[model samples]
Target: MALFVGLTGGIASGKSTVARLLSARNIPVIDTDLISRELVEPGQPCLNELCQHFGPEILNEDGHLNRKTLREKIFTDSSARAVLETILHPQIRRIAKERAEQSATQAPYVLVVVPLLADPKVQPHYQWLDYVVGVRATPAIQKARLLERPGIDPPLADQMISAQSSDRERDAIVNEWIVNTGDLTTLARQVDQCHHKLLMLTAERTSSE
Candidate 1:
């Protein structure tokens, strides 16, 4: 009877930080990004589909995904990105759901960190989610965060940010929003408040069931 909360946001919007804080409080968090990576490892079926579409060059000498190449390919080409999403999103959602269900046995509520919960194609599949929390930040902050990453230039960072749904779009659908444009202390305070609220909601849900 655990509530499923879908935590999502734009890239570099501090979703991971929020997830970590929730986990520290003994709440289970299932990350879809990690699941996507796992499904693309050397021998996975998703990787095989990727290879068939993007070709062997998309893999490194070690037969692992050449993430840099693929990232560049998809970000620059919308069609390629759509194709890749078609191949991976379903599988990632399936695994995320499975993991969240497993986590429900251990926690009062489960958090599923989904980066594309706002995407039209991906949103419908997540109807099981009882709540959607958007971790948001100003575009400037998101760009700066992306720039801090290794090998990411301003233009590339901008491209990556532009590739995802805007903050307004995410804000429109989320039940609650976490603004992460300030310091860690501020973000922590928001997380704490959200945590308290979720706990109350979870208790109500459990009692109703």
Candidate 2:
């Protein structure tokens, strides 16, 4: 079997940057965030279920997901958030697994980017991962990065950061850490190290088998 590695981090923690770096090195990466978005496209079963539960207001006039409206609803209501997760998380995991398996045909191992992998509720579902790497930045840095995004005010940015797993929590589960506290060059160097480590692990697994 091909080794499956998980890449995860909190909001604004540079997970995308790491994934991009890995892709640049010719690594095969299956990103759950992208899968989740695809799963909710117009006429998809996930979107249909979401409309049933959250109402049609969650969709824009063009039939795409009105993310802002859904975000406001979920952030204010825990039960609503739970419902959304219930409808989407399993589908995301299923598609991610499928893509990873397909990618494994061409790569020694597959990298799966799961933004919420450290959450207690989400962690159990990913036990099959052979390894997990976490990208981390200080809370202050996370807040600053979040606030820079369009439509992200101070209060919403803070709320989003607080809702994710803490650095300590992530550290407890991740096998490796990539600290993203500096410029692109610094982040790129760390990603290069991580890529080399993953290649070593993949070779070891292949030889053992």
Candidate 3:
């Protein structure tokens, strides 16, 4: 069986960066965010449901999902966020599981990237994860990185960062933590070390089986 390792962190904490590095090393990384986007594509059933509840304004002129508009609504409205999660989480979880299972057949382990693994709704779905890896950075670093993104102002950046698990809270749950306070070279080194450790663990598990 493939060992499932969850990779999660706060907003702008370099979870994607770490996942990219792992992918480059031939490790399978299942990114749930990408799967979520696919689920709401132009003709998907979830997109139709979203339009029915949130209205046509949720789509752009090209008839694609207006992610910007949806982001604004969810961030500013708690109820809207809750309702949207209600529609998307289950589908995303199902799809993610299917992808992870497929990936497992091809690799000894799989890294599942979930931005909100700490969220209550999301946490339960991933309880079966064999291990969790949390990428962490100081609040200042997180805020600065978030501000660099397009359409993200100070308040929204702060809001997004604050919405997820605290660094402390995440640290408590993850089996391993990667601190991304420095440059990419430093972060890469950390990722390499983590990857080596994961490989060792995988070898042990496979041998036992």
Query: lDDT tens digits, residues 1-209, model 2?
Result: 56799999989999999999998888899999999899999999999999999999999999999998898888777899899999999999888888888898887778999999988899999898999999999999999998888888888888788877888988888999999999999999998988888888888888888
The lDDT of each candidate is: 0.92, 0.90, 0.89
**Superposed Cα deviation of residue 12, candidate 3 (Å):** 0.7
* Runs in model 1 lying further than 4 Å from the true structure: none
Runs in model 3 with CA error above 4 Å? Answer: none
Candidate 3 lDDT, 93-125, residue by residue in tens: 888888888899887789999889887667888
Superposition error at 93 for model 1 (Å): 1.1
Candidate 1 structure quality by residue, lDDT tens digits, 1-209:
88999999999999999999999999999999999999999999999999999999999999999898899889999999999999999888889999999999998899999999898878899999999999998889899998888878898888999999887888767999999988999999999999999989999988888
The estimated TM-scores of all candidates read 0.97, 0.96, 0.96
Q: Candidate 1, residue 193: CA error in Å?
A: 0.7
